[model samples]
Target: MDVTKKKVLNGYHVIFLVQNVMIGMSLLSLNNSLSAVGYSQWWFPILFGIIANITLIPMVWLSLQYKDDDLFDIHEKLLGKWIGKFLNTFLIIYAVVLFSAIIQHYLDLIQISVLPERKITGHLILFILLTVFIVKGGIKSLARFCILTFFLMGWIVYFLRWGIMYGEVSHLLPLFNFSSSEFWEAFRNGYNSMIGYEFLMFFFPYIIHPQKAFKHASIGIWITILFYLSVTIVGAMYFSEWQLENLFFPILKLFQAVDLTFVERIDTFGITIWVFLILTTAGAYLWMAKKGIDSVREKNSNYHIYAVAIFTYIIINLPFTQVMKETLYEKDFYVSYGLILWPTVLCIVHLVRWKKKEVV
Candidate 1:
């Protein structure tokens, strides 16, 4: 269908899509994840941002090579059909698992914090329906939704001022205090927050200004980095080392610092609003998974979206043990990290093919 010709996503869409996707469930617990470095964790998002930008270069470079082809199509062209399809199967699985993981994690948090008395089944069903609706509209629709989510949810950052006002500035001192092992531990644990930027590989074909995409996407990333940095710095300043280490979602604790008259339980309010971020993140993955299914079957159909959504629903609802679920959702991020780096391998393949063509 030459989907690239239908590119409707502008630079702002690219920016917001990159930003919102990276801002999902992870932000809530990001401080906890980076607790290995103690107070020094405030700058970790910057480190993550730097790594994300470096990795971003290869992805954008590869996408520029085939302006009309997404990562799935690029795989087929570069590696040949059978091998590419084999690799794409794993990509599809990665997308589905990631979509399921983000949804499950958010729903679980809601159960713990807001709807503890209620079973998550209702929440799960509602979330899937909303996600399916967003993905069904396709990438342009999803991009618009991402833009809306960014504006709507971006205001919540203002609430962090309460924590900043009350927190001690001295907590940010003793910089670089962590050992080398601790830095590595913090990096490993917190890198998941940076995962969404890689989806740029999947959507690059739809960008209206592909050349400016790197600039726009970089802006989006730094915006998220600044947001994360603000929250982490406030968290470091506001909480004790024990709280930073033990509180599962320190941002929620930061939320408790809000002493407003009209708003009671602002944390719960924040969690409720978080559904928008979750929707955009899951919607992007679901859309990519649907595209993967279409590429595999060599047909375009709305049913692909539904099929992936159903599969995601079942995967999340499965009665796996807590440990098993954690392993699948948390530990399986190696697939995402691999996807981020996969473009470098493809770039090498591209150069070889170019040389061979020249020799011919």
Candidate 2:
């Protein structure tokens, strides 16, 4: 019963995946959302983001101890086979639904900004088809794609800061305008934008260098939080709260507002860079969904399942609409039900089972 892995993407690849996965299109709307919660104290979410990762360190360690078993397998070992299967099913659905919603939102932005009259369904199909083709290449190709995005992330951040030198500082005035509860509430809900961290459960087993995963994931979380905090601060300073709350892409809006002597349209440039970041994030989730299937007994399941799931996502989002997308964010905090609570409880039960077996 030796289960061999067909997915060959390694640890170096995981580093890139870590960077790419967190830099989602939502990075643009963070400030606007924070503002909606009536808080200019933007550091609160950044602090919570750091703390959340620290809290998950035990889960990370327990995951590594299993010789690279993904969360699904770990669940199966502790919970019964049926219960594990049910959880995995929910995870698959969760990823597909959540990412589909994301794709639709981005497509909504492009349609409104780039082509006001273009149909989203066709564009969504074409875009998701592109995503599927890439995933079909399997883990190695996906990992390499992620590596490319890491460089993109670094350069884009540098360009954004350097390119927009003329941004207004007054926009950031009266930073302490909101109450403590309002700030913390916004921070707690905003954690969903940092949603990709949960994928480590599926990806840890595939990591070519398992030993570095905890360290790398830790560093990755810190870097992502810093980037997010910086982006929020920049957006906060560049755009008024009302403008941000209504704008689909606040980061791009900030760029659009800037007028340096040499550059007339930093916003267009920002959108272009965003395409790469968004594609990488979407692709990483598709890959993780595929990898989650690797946890099953059938060794080759991930390779095929990933492709199928991508096509399925295409169907779900192809006819997607722009209405009430914020409703998804409503459930953002609710993800704790699955991502944190369920996994944490299962991990403890797993340890108890392991200890009892050792005694026997």
Candidate 3:
């Protein structure tokens, strides 16, 4: 495998990366998740998402403080060398676990929802082959793949339109308030689904053109939220707060309800978009993990290290039981919670440690 050096992503490419990272299982789970609180509060995640990203900005900006040095440099400098190394080690484990969980989730999703009778192992092989294909393409090719997924963007828009056409406004009236406890639980539960901001830790260094970094990143978040808000609205609109109560993947089912004269099976189209979304999510995390490994080397060298890092990730995706797959998600969520909080705190700690009176 020839590991070619790639340029940083452009402005539009950043939007692609951001949307892809946040869309995957979260979109699939949004209905079930919002349903956890009742559809009356599906918009809570929408609001919570905006708030969470507001808090996340400082952490992302902190990474830029060391824009020239990558995350490990930022970590070591603020916390001292040993602590930075320890954090780097933790990041590697975090990325691998996150990657594996997505693999497990995507495979389980395709097998259960669309290809019920197909052999489970077939999904696993597709996972590995696609992972290899995207990684081999490197970041540049990953951007192009994101561009290709734009073709499916039309389908997403159409799905939303069709669902809305059949949706009744009366289904959404009578805003009922849950107890304080339920509201908080719903908000937090929705927050759990809004992952992927901390990825800037690894990817910020690769945005290529630093001058436009913040501009591109902001556009990415806004677009992601817009796309997902439509998803939330579709779920809450088509299904009554009561109807969507316990259904998992209502977003998928919403599309399932669409019946075109010639395009009888909309499930196929849904699965296709899901697969495209999966690649972007997987590719982003893999790029982060791969970038971290490359940072340990001197710029660009043999592809062996990158190959082994990703190959190990591929092996980790193999699981025989559904329970095991869900457990991976549970574990990744807990671990990611730390990633979200730590980076923010690390930035403050760095600022105090440096004792800079003003921004350097």
Candidate 4:
């Protein structure tokens, strides 16, 4: 591999990459999703941040062990080629399904919240084409795009102050009143917002500073946590318990509170600008799927990228009922939980094998 083409990501790119990936469409629904815990739900994002940090350790450790390989290659190294190929195929499918789900959910939101007349297939086609363009330039290009997305979409946070001003401080009271079941339910419901950080496992080899990767990645995760925490807190304060439970995209409702005289219906603009965040997310997954294909073939080619992108494009465009689509997307949450545990299991396997070899 050419040096120019490989090992190009620095610390901040890694940081922003993780941050942008973690903060996606899920941020909009997160407050509503966690409303099960009511006023105390503000702290759930902090819990997610802690979990994100912990799950990240095994992934980072495993990647540092094979500095040149992504998780797909690491899977083959840790398992025999045949078993690894099987698992890798499954992982590729997971990536494509995940990509489809994210795109579908985002497009659905756009259709419902912003652009009602446009065909979903039209939006998906344009989105996937743009994503393929980014993915084709390879991971470095994708990382740079993520950086751009962070700067572009991040200012939306400033709008939260409007929600805060209209919010009642009393809604934030009785913060610890939730039971364990409510907390667990809220945690599970909100965990999907934290899903994208695991993409780090697949892109770790590109990081120039693997030794400090954890620190930088943690910073990114914390940045996401800060945004999530702020939004959740503001949302808790802003919406009544019943309103929080009912609003599908609480962030959009938050945007509605903004008193911008020049731009009426700011959420319409928010959804339009939010395309970058969705692109960053869907592009990352598409790249990972492409990488998995390349790993299986033992070579790199743009054909794999196009194939996966097309597959994803088709998957989302399929005429599944809304109920079916929701079910499929819901399944991804469990699949993601499995992906998080996967690294820790692999690390344990590696450690055991090393120990036996040392003893021998």
Ordered list by TM-score, greatest first: 1, 4, 3, 2
- Candidate 1: global Cα-lDDT? 0.90
lDDT of 3: 0.67
Q: Per-prediction TM-score, please? A: 0.98, 0.84, 0.87, 0.97
lDDT of each: 0.90, 0.65, 0.67, 0.87
**In model 1, what are the clashing residue pairs, if there are any?**
none
Where model 3 places Cα greater than 4 Å from the true spot, the runs are: 1-7, 174-176, 296-321, 356-360
Model 4, span 1-360: residue lDDT tens: 212327889999999889998887889998888988988888888889998999999999998899988888888888879889889999998888988888888888889888777777777888889988988888889889999998888888999999889888888778798889988888888998898888988888888889999999999999999999999999998988888899989889889889987999999999889989999988888888888888888787788888988788777768888899889878876898999889999999899888999999
Give the range of the ten consecutive residues with the poorest summed lDDT in model 3.
296-305
lDDT of 2 by residue, 87-158 (tens): 776776566656665676677777767778877677676767677766767656666777777676566555
Model 4 sits at a Cα RMSD from the real structure of: 1.5
> So what's the TM-score on candidate 1?
0.98
Per-residue lDDT value at 251 in model 3: 74
**For model 3, which pairs clash?**
8-208
What order do you get sorting by lDDT, best first?
1, 4, 3, 2
Cα deviation of 78, candidate 4, in Å = 1.0
lDDT at position 279, candidate 2: 70
Query: What TM-score number comes out for model 3?
Result: 0.87
Q: For residues 1-360, could you state the per-residue lDDT of candidate 1 as single tens digits?
A: 223337878999999999999888989999999999999999899889999999999999999999999999999999999999998888899899999989989998999999988998888989999998888777989988998998888888898888889999999998899999999999988998898999998889889889998999999999999999998999999988899899999999889889999999999999999999999999989988988988999988888888998898889878889789989987567788888888999999999999999999
